[model samples]
Target: MSRLKLAICVLDDIQPLRRVGSMANDALVLLFMIAIVLVVMAVTLIGGFYLVKYLVERTFNS
Candidate 1:
């Protein structure tokens, strides 16, 4: 019984460390997701700009 109580106390002490690791992982995942979103948005904007330029040039040349 004393061993079991000691084991539980040790686990309780370690729980906060595990939570800190989990929070760090969550923060990394969030940053990665934000980067992906920004990249996608930038690509879309650049593509749209080129598409518009191409159409305008074609209209004026034809």
Candidate 2:
């Protein structure tokens, strides 16, 4: 039937768009993971710096 052929063609045309949407979703997930890792690293570095400063001050002052 001509109508069935037309529907199949439309579905084929839209399949690439669906694939692109999934790819974008994957990229966003990866970006968020990288951001989280960077944030954690920054927090630990800052905390360690302050902790060392505290220990050094305590050792020399006392």
Candidate 3:
């Protein structure tokens, strides 16, 4: 009976650690997604700026 109780206690202790590990993984995935979004936004902004500048110059010059 004491052995069973000890086993249960060990399991309980491990459960919280498992939850903490899962939370850490979720946080890492969120950070990765945010970084991807930032990179895409930066690329779009730079491309858009050049496109608009080219169009304006062409329209005015022609």
Candidate 4:
């Protein structure tokens, strides 16, 4: 029906704005979580690197 088509057209405009806002919110949350994971991984990598280096040096020197 033409009325149904008109109704859908009206809803389509509003739908995108709502979807954009929700997508932005989701993206922000995902980035924040990713940053936290990266920080943790970086710290662990740094600590492990130093540990491996220390052990290798000690072994070779001794």
TM-score for each model? 0.86, 0.93, 0.88, 0.59
Off by over 4 Å in 1: none
**Rank ordering of all candidates by TM-score, starting from the highest:** 2, 3, 1, 4
Q: Name model 3 segments beyond 4 Å from true.
A: none
- Model 2 alpha-carbon drift over 4 Å, by segment: none
In candidate 4, list every pair of residues with a backbone clash. none
Winner of 1 and 4 under TM-score? 1
Error of 1 at 52 (Å): 0.6
Kindly list the per-residue Cα lDDT of model 3 for residues 1-62, writing each as its tens digit: 99999999999999999999999999999999999999999999999999999999999999
> Cα lDDT for residue 31, model 4?
100
Residue-wise lDDT of candidate 1 within 1-62, one digit each (tens)?
A: 99999999999999999999999999999999999999999999999999999999999999
Clash counts for the predictions, in order: 0, 0, 0, 0
Assess candidate 3 and give its TM-score to the true structure.
0.88
Clashing pairs in 1: none
Please give, for residues 1-62, the per-residue lDDT of candidate 2 as tens digits. 99999999999999999999999999999999999999999999999999999999999999
Output the worst ten-in-a-row residue range by lDDT, candidate 3. 11-20
The ten-residue window of minimal lDDT in model 2 covers: 1-10
Off by over 4 Å in 4: 1-16
Residue 25 in model 2: shift from native, Å? Answer: 0.6
